[model samples]
Target: MNDLPFLQHFIVLPVLLPLLAGALLIPVKQSRYSLKFACSVTSTILLWVLAAVLLAMADGGYWPDGIGVYLASNWAAPFGIALLVDRLTALMLLLTATIALAVLVFSARRWDRVGIQFHTLFQFLLMGLNGAFLTNDLFNLFVFFEVMLAASYGLVLHGYNLHRIRAGMQYIAINLVASFMFLIGVALIYAASGTLNLTDLGARVALLGNEDTWLLSIGVCVLGLAFLTKGAMWPLGFWLPGTYASASAPVAAMLVLMTKVGVYAVLRVWLAVFGNDAGALAGFGFTALTIGGMATLFFGAIGMLASQDGGRMAGYGAIISSGTLLAVIGQAGGPVLASGLYYLLGSTLAMAAFMLLVELTERIRPPGAALIAITMEAFAIEDKPEDPVGQGIPGTLAFLGLSFAACALVISGMPPLSGFVAKFSLFHALLEVSPTEGKVPGLTWGFIALVIVGGLAAIIALMRLGVRIFWASGDIAPPRLQFSEAAPVTALVALCVMLTLQAGTVFDYLDRTVAGLAQVTTYSERVLGEPPVMRSPQRGLER
Candidate 1:
């Protein structure tokens, strides 16, 4: 598949198809929503299939360094916009498409009615997400970032109320500042190195002398802050719980993938320009990434324990997932990064599924039962017997209970799920350090402890949510759940189960991904073309 010349053309389809679909959707009347829905869904399904093919192409070795590039114009790097796809990029595309499909199906029942042009915005969001994963330059990355954020601004406020309005405003304000910082950082990097192309920047950054090193460092740090803000790191992330809590269920699920996008940016850019070739500039900012990851995890743990609502708790779970990935990236080793990648997949699916389930389970709970359940669990009250769960249970009750349990198992890293496998792999990777290496750092211990405590906190919070939704709510009749609503949640949870069953295969794939990302020189060379690189002299030093 990788050797097929004709298949290389499909690299541009992921971006182009969604873009064309979104443009077409704009003219359809709201009265013609069925047409809009059909177009949106069919495009997404085709996207999911296309992404699966690309994932296979990359894994089968599409090009040197396992990266396939599509030049938007005939011009080469630092001139024309370039889109590069590798195993990691392909993995994200598939993940984004999966979640988008589920969210679209889940929203079909009612939330689509909240506003005009909902499907239009949804397709554009997919376009932005696919473009972000595929782009190979900083400036193009920013353009896609704005596209995604712009679509989200509308989606977040779809069913406008006072709460949604306030949350959406905060989301908009923070991202605008982040966008400003991203632009400034790009300007600084270009001014120092004479290019905005990622591969060009990578090559030039390595050649930079002491004169431009500090400026490059400052620019990279500024970029990191913007991405960290998007990833929901501590101090900058206090708005996440409220934003997710107030969002409609499917929108919140989309936000779940959005959080991971920030983490993905940090992972790609940091390692690319700062890899082994960067000379004294190598390994810059990793310490800060570690410390920040710990702080974010600690903050998430406290927030999880304190949360009473399911939406808010799921928000904190995303914070914890981001924190874990950031910390693993800070470790900067193949084994640990492989583990973290698997963890990212499982936690993302589980959290998104849980967010969807929250809307349905709320149907069964009394208005104040979460608080009451918390009090009862804290005090160990004995009045409530276990609800009969296994046999003769109403089908609706049974479905919600099992789905919620699967989510808890995955999020909390409990036995018999992919979450457990992820954490165990992490622990093993941390312990399996080569004999040539020094004693384990305290930061490693700190990360281990944080993972443990974070998992415990999730267990408590989600367990309490379970008690409230299923046990304390007593004998309420099942709320009406549409097939569209139930199927999406079922599909997502089932994916986690599949991950657990196929853990070995998934881990091998992730390991190859980690290995591919380490080839920084190859990445730069392939994107820049086969000739000897024309050096970019340092700019603005004389000015």
Candidate 2:
């Protein structure tokens, strides 16, 4: 497949492939669940392969900026359709595909069979995620954002219940307001800066007058509000925990990736448009991002400590992950962003795997069981705990315990896992690069202190939860397991393990990625430099 002539066109395949598959699945009769499932699975597998190849291609450094720009309909940037990919984009593609495939398989056992609508929206949501990562145009990004959100609405409401319905409506309302702000911000941006193409905005923004710059800043702040809302910042993220907790397990897992998409947007826009190259606009929002991130991190840490609900607990874990990434991006210097990206990969995978496991654990611990388990864990019982050798442990229970521990270790940044590696690297980078390098570096101590505290909070919360699920629940029969359901969660956790083993190679790649992103001119030149795919019949038949 890599040898194929059109493989250079692979940049567009992630977006197109899912769109085509989803569209085709729409007409399949509801009774033909098997066929729909097969198509969805096939498309997802193909997407994974395609993503792997794309990541490899970027690693080859074929483009000077490590960015690949594809002009659609023979059009160019700021004028014609454009899609772009750099190492970051390719990495995002692979991450999306990896998680989507896992979640889809996890659904295959029962969730997919419960309804075919989920099957269709599943692929369409993939399409939206892929497009969002690949597209260079802000308008195109908005289109994909809506596409993703639209599918998410259905997914959140998939297994309708009062809790889900209520959460879905609030999710919709918050995002709709965000979308409205996105539009207003874009309009004001165009009025103030004259371009919506990211590269163009980077180049043109600094040239504006005082009035225009002020207007542009307002517009950018507005636009960023939408992303912050999506990114789940404090105050703006009031809707996230409820919405994520209410979605079906597989859908909730996908929402982990969904949350990162918001972070990705914030990362891209903040770097591309407000970098040191933007003159007066340079470093405009870094302080705000830092404050917001620290606040969100603290909020999430406390929320996790306070919440007993499994789903909401996972949601708060995601919030901590987001806060970490947001704080890193706000740093704007040092070698920390790579560490943040690394953390992003691990936390996203771990959180998703944990969310998937939540439903299975719930099967063993009913509402009353959870209450009982908590009581048993918090209060003392007579001696003679279970056999020290664990003689009576069921295989299913053992597997759950191991998987749950792995996820907890990773999410909490405990030792011997990728999450710890990420946090350690982050602290190392921060220490090496002083606060003077970043505006919010003044708050650098705060960030580091909170990160340590946050990790501690996660450890305590997860440890308590684990005891409740495994130890306190009275002797119970092992729940029935399906290969499809169990494999996905196991695979995701393994991926985090793999990340730990291969940290050096992955960090090198991300280091190269951050270096490429630092050179704003290269990205702009790559997008703006591509010659038209064809010219008017070689200039009217050469006269």
Candidate 3:
């Protein structure tokens, strides 16, 4: 291991260490506390490694943007596990580690209540997430996905209460279907392409004939379905709110990583495997982007409008953000990619932080109240039941106002925050693609105007709701937050502050990341040898 090159080993360690630690925790005495300690230590180290990787990526420049680092047991592509760390992969790894840390910190109290299995399951889930991000092989991506999903099944159903069970079952069923589709997609892809290693496939996919092209189309569709399902895309996302709503705070926070994995896979595989060849497969790439994205965006917005429950509302918002991210990706060019990177980092961090806040609110509720009110009725519980009466409604309203404001800023892509940066960049991208200088024709302008209008509507709606919730008079009493519970919220706020202050640095980092991905030549050379024959005939034809 010591003789191995640093770059070859660095990427995989983040995945392997946690898995090994989780396995080690299983048989140890007082495994619960020991597991927690192990996870904390291991995750902290991983975080450092992740930071180092990001810095290295930034420094190394985009010269090798699409370069796939192979960890061959000294074996070649068709065999052995390979951990690839391209710009996108590196960014996702940092994000996953960041969120995992926050979730773990928030879960400290629940860890005491839930027992050892929660920690073990969580570690395993993280291992799966990290593995998915770094893995170069498509089959192994599916394998990592299943590992995470299986661990998630247990975590979702951890308490095994009736409500949790019901929700968990639905969640499991939906994901099971997705998993099956994913496997079938992989099979179809293998049949058509004859390889599962992403780099190798990218090198060879252009050589496919019409028959293989049709099969590959089906495979891409199936794979897209699986990713959309996991990412909580519209129509397929009906299960997300209920499942996330029922889970413990930490579990819900951790579950966010699942959506990210799906997103990462789509970006990694599509960009490299397809290598900017947008004309392939009867324009399947553009079709997936436009049709799938619009539907997801509309579904998420409608879901948010329809939601009454607080946690569920946030859950829908998460869906909307995911859709927006994908929409930006589908619309990819220079500006859109930059925007997506910014939003992906910012929104995920924001959502993770907000989710942690909601959990804290549950914990700080009145002493006599159950940690969570299981009754189906709309209820507000508080900490210190003896503190006073008639303050609940006001307090709830205040908290709701804060949440709503953050949500507005996040979803609307408003100024002075990360969300705005993403949206603006995306709009810029649309402007680039539009043929008309004053007004673009077709989907480009259509999407631009629609997204802008949607963002504005969301902002207004959230603001109005915030006013009603915070200012409206209701006799309900308020809950209080302890310092420990407040820690996560404070950490998130600190992150927001850092994001604001270091906006320039953040943008530079994202630009570097995008530049890395957009290097078509680097990608072509790495995957397809010295130079790909740019068929001028293929290049000049417009769809």
Query: In order, how many clashes per candidate?
Result: 0, 0, 10
The lDDT per prediction is 0.86, 0.87, 0.67
lDDT of 3 by residue, 90-158 (tens): 667777777777676655544434544666677788888878887878888999999999999988877
The TM-score, computed over Cα atoms with residue i paired to residue i, of candidate 1 is: 0.92
In model 3, which runs have C-alpha deviations exceeding 4 angstroms?
Answer: 1-4, 29-35, 38-41, 61-68, 277-279, 363-404, 436-439, 460-482, 524-543
333-423 per-residue lDDT for model 2 (tens digits): 7498999999999999999999999987876775576568557555533221111121233488788889999999999999999999999
lDDT of 1: 0.86
Off by over 4 Å in 2: 1-5, 366-394, 435-442, 535-543
Q: Mark the 10 consecutive residues where model 1 has the least summed lDDT.
A: 381-390
TM-scores of the models, in the order given? 0.92, 0.92, 0.84
lDDT tens readout by residue for model 1, 1-543: 333556766888998998899999888888776788889999999999999999988888556667888777546776888888899999999999999999998877477766778898998888888888899888899999999999999998887766778888999999999999999988888878888888788788868878788888888888888889999999888889999998988999999999998899989888888778888788888778888998999999999999999999999999999999998888888999999999999999999999999988887877476568557555543322122232333598889999999999999888899999999999889877622356777788888999999999999999999998888877787766778888899999999999999999999999999998999888877888833223457642110
TM-score: which candidate is best? 2
- Compute the lDDT of residue 127 as modeled in candidate 1: 87
